[model samples]
Target chain A: MSVTILYKEQPPFPVMATPDGDDLWLTLDDLRSATGWEIRPEGVCREGQCVPIPEGREREFVRESPPRFNLAALARWLEQPVLHDDVHGVWFFGEAARVRRETLRSLQAPDFRLPDLEGRMHSLANYRGKKIFLVSWASW
Target chain B: MWQGLYDELKDRSFVVLAVALDSGGVASAGQWILAAKPTYPCLIDERHVVAELYSMVNVPSAVWIDEAGRIVRPTEVAGASDAFRTQMDRKTKQVSAEGIADRQRTRTAYLNALRDWTAKGAESPFAVSRDEVRRRSSGPSDEHVFAAAHFRLGEYLYTQGHREAALPYFSEARRLHPASWSYRRQTWELEEPGKAGGPDFWSAVDALGDRSYYPPVTL
Candidate 1:
């Protein structure tokens, strides 16, 4: 089946997956596409972080027949919040507790890139050299 | 109001970035932005990503970021005062003279503090310390974390033309993080046009009783 992955604040994208009960298993390439993480000899690695797969529990995360990765298990290990809509094949992954904690500790404004009405892209980082009164409102 | 403030401080290197948290996207928020004719950057957040990132529970919430990109103040209610709710005639929806005066006073105080921060940067009394900023920041609780995830899924499903399927997730988000007016209002307005500020909104306000609609401005 195909699944839509909504990762953080980024745009959602779809990837092929094997659904098992409540979990979605994906090939290594699909895993990388769904999440930025890739399985290496060291474990699942992304950027500066490499989490080693638990010894003797490799079967829980890896399947040999078609070679699939258990994204649900990895999410649990990282303490990343994952919400799934079974009927719609959509999954939403939120920031890990540790990541949010680090951001809070840094006391830096979280950066985001969004589009203005004219479809011009603007990033919070672009306004780094000035005082910013960032306010949120709604038409509703 | 924001445009006027932005005009006053833009030359001083201050920027007012207004984010519209509307699930209805450009179709809903663009009209207001067009009318305001703001010179500052006005971005539309169709997915409420800013709310999730900043742990913002309501609209009109704000964060003060310094020149170096440090947060001087974390998310808190910004403009509208309790007087708008408490002092208005329930039938006519008109604010009492006292209410209007009180609302004006609250708005002026907030704006003055903003001006002070723009003028003095880190030295302003209104600029909170790093420790205080960290302390005040609402790191999402487990419920809030899940709530945001559910909200995201709900938004996706709704936009995908699975409107009925989206309701459960939206309801779950609201149940998990009731403090989030953004979650509730977005879901309500998406479910039914104008339901956001309808009688349900007033009932929710009435239910608050002693609790405030917006947290009082600390400055």
Candidate 2:
């Protein structure tokens, strides 16, 4: 069997899939390309951050059939809200925007690491004591 | 826009940092920064993380942080000073067939509010409470989350030199978030042919009709 994966922005792409005990398994490469995430030994990683996949859950996610990951299990590990249309073989993995919105109520800015044009790393933590007038503009 | 504000407020323990969300390429953005010769830090957000972090749907959005690092104002269409509006009016006049009367008025009112906030600080009526900020910006929904994901993917693919592969994702993102001019503007400018120097692009017939993209501020 095969499954067609549909993400929010990109066109739908299909990958070969096979039925497991009760879940469907997709190849590691397909998952990585579709989601921009890789299931490393450290669990799932993008950019530099890695979320360590817990011990027993590793077995639950990985299947020997073409060496793939279970779609449901991957979404659970990432703690992302997911919606799937089984008949259509489509899946949408969303970000933590809801959590982000809630956190905004606390007025505490979310922290992330970014590089300045000079190639120096600057984290929001560095600006902890200083006020930031974060102006978002475009050259266009 | 920030130069005078930054210079004047610098002695008052205030600082202005501009985050340029120029995804297609950095050269033009860099050039603009050089011409301005700002003392404040101007950072580039190739992936537009800062926009996503603040749920900003358009360029020129700003978030005001208090001395304690708390958000005094959530992301809003923020450039109130005359300098900024004059610059905007000049550019919009050149490109847009219609006069930018509405946008000019909006910017004038916004600058007034900004002055009040700067003067009064915590006591200012313009400074929103934490709850009010969140409520007004409106908590993100599934569409917002999905749009953000698509935007990131599109930006990544485009920067990777996979322009063909990136187009569909950009289309989908624009479809999902019609109000988000930042998504469309960045992509559209990349598609722009010839004419490549210093702030020429503005609302075109194709860019969601020839109107001021900036939504009116409540303040």
Candidate 3:
């Protein structure tokens, strides 16, 4: 199946998956494309961290017969929030709770980059060494 | 209003980064930004990323950041006064003398506090300690986290021309996180032009009872 993956604030990307009930099973390549993770001999590994699949729980996250990885199960294990729009075939993933809590404790302003009316990108990081009154509004 | 403040404080190394949380993107928020003729960096957030990142629930919410990118003040209602709701006629949009006066007073106080912070930096009485800022900041709960994902999915579907298909996800997001006026209002406005402040809004505000619509800014 072809499904869309919406991650963080980036644009959604399409990937191939085999969704069973609520669990979205993707091939190792598709898993790496949708989420920046790959299942290694050690465990599911990303750039900075490696989360080892629990002992005897490998069946829940992997299937050797078809060679598929369960993204929903991995998200659950990592405490990353997931939402599925079955009708549209889209899976949305949110930041892990640990990351948000770390930001909260550090009291650092959460940084973001967004485009202006003319399509010029501005970053919160660019405003360092200045006092920022970051205000959000809406037309409606 | 933000432009005026920005003009006053720009020479002091202060910037007012006004963000528009409109899913309609430039089409909806463009005219307002143009009308302001702002010189500051005015950005449009189609995904409501800033709101989700800062745990902000409503429009006109703000967070103050200092020179080192530390959050001096956490997200809170920026400068709106409740007199608009309490003193104005629902249909006529007429406000009483008291309402105008109260609105002006509250906005002035908020602007003054902002000015003090801009002038004095971390030494300002308005600048809170690191612990206090952390205390005021809220990390999203499991429900809120899921609500954000659902809301983003709804936004994607809506943009992909599946308007009817998008409604259920939007409704689910509202149900999961009722405190987020941004989610509710964004969906309502995208559905219809002026529906955000209509009967549904009044009914919700009335239900608040003694609870405040805008969180009181403790300066």
Candidate 4:
């Protein structure tokens, strides 16, 4: 499973997925609030695991455990991220969780067949034995 | 990036396929592809069936499938070349100064990083390891899921001329998934009074009715 964030319906940045066999989608705000990192060009931090947000030159920090509990790390361990809405001050936890690039032990890439401009069939199964790089783009 | 790289590695057991998600069918996407004249298998996804299947929500998104039909790189696969950004930035510096430059700059940077990963593959400095990738791919809560459903239903209804009915779905989509661009864009487009072909209808949220209707766009 994987997590994705959408803005007005379009993907704004790269979506984040967690490990632990859960697939969930997340927004940038969702990641920031859960990790306690400002959305500014700094770094992403939670309880124990923190990833540096390097847009420009930024310093890195060590992942440390909190005395009581690393809620962020616990979220990571559980394969879920905390989500908060600044607009409504509402918060919730996602059930299905996933992380990006983690070797998908159960991920099955969906098969698809679609026509091109000339109405020719383009199928995913055609590239069964080859390393296929599929990209999606639009004119608009 | 993949195009040129594919040319280099195609004979070495590598293949690259480009799918255009253009809603205007192949006409627009084909024109662009032909102009670039990419040597790879450039196809088109008119109905967005592949997008729906792969959970693709944006353009220029990529997925890498190994020979075993396993997804080595999923929906967030970025491109391999920074050519798009370099050209965009250079043109922005020379073009008209109507705020389009800033927009182009930001968009260009985003595309550049994607290209870097594509070119370098897993060796790319920006490429996340299997662990990091998994850690980052998790999605939002159920509220957002229902919101996405509502947004899709609203878009379907709006297209069917059920504007009033669509309004409720769009409203719910926004309320449930406040961060969704699909939900917000659909609603904004419906309420927009401007000409359709002029510019992006929801280019600026400030022009929309209530700023509080959407979340802050950090990108």
TM-score of each: 0.96, 0.69, 0.95, 0.47
lDDT of 3 by residue, A1-140 (tens): 78998867767879877778879888888888767888878899987689999899989999997799998898888888888877668888888867787887788888999999999999999999999999999988
lDDT of 2 by residue, B1-219 (tens): 678777766766667778888874457577788788888777777767777667888778988877777888888888532223334345344523223554456666766666666667788888887668778766566676667667666665566576776677777777887777677677666556332222433333224353545655667
Look at candidate 4 and tell me the lDDT of residue A135.
81
lDDT of 1 by residue, B46-101 (tens): 88888877889997999998989989988888866889787988778899999999
Candidate ranking under TM-score, highest first, comes to 1, 3, 2, 4
DockQ numbers for every candidate?
Answer: 0.84, 0.37, 0.81, 0.23
Model 1 is docked with a DockQ of 0.84
* TM, chain A, every candidate: 0.90, 0.59, 0.86, 0.26
**Candidate 2 residue spans exceeding 4 A from truth:** A1-72, A76-94, B80-120, B193-212
- Tell me the tens digit of each residue's lDDT in model 1 across A1-140: 88888877767879987667767788888788767889888999987799999999998888988889998888887899987877777877788867876886788788999999998999999999999999999999
| Candidate 3 chain A, poorest ten consecutive residues by summed lDDT | A96-105
The TM-score measured for candidate 3 stands at 0.95
Predictions ranked by lDDT, top down? 3, 1, 2, 4
True contacts kept of each: 0.88, 0.64, 0.91, 0.59
- Worst 10-residue lDDT window, candidate 4 chain A: A59-68
Query: Which stretch of 10 consecutive residues in model 4 chain B shows the poorest summed lDDT?
Result: B210-219
Put down candidate 4 lDDT per residue, A18-97, tens digits, no spaces: 32222232344545544343333344544454554433422122222321222334344444434433222222332232
Reference-based lDDT, residue B27, model 2: 75
> Per-residue lDDT of A1-140 in model 2, one digit per residue for the tens?
66655443344567777644445577788877766668777777866878777787678777675588776676656655555445434455555665667767778876756655665667666766655677877777
Model 1 scores a C-alpha lDDT of 0.87
Which candidate ranks first by DockQ, i.e. highest? 1
Q: Place model 4 in a CAPRI quality band.
A: incorrect
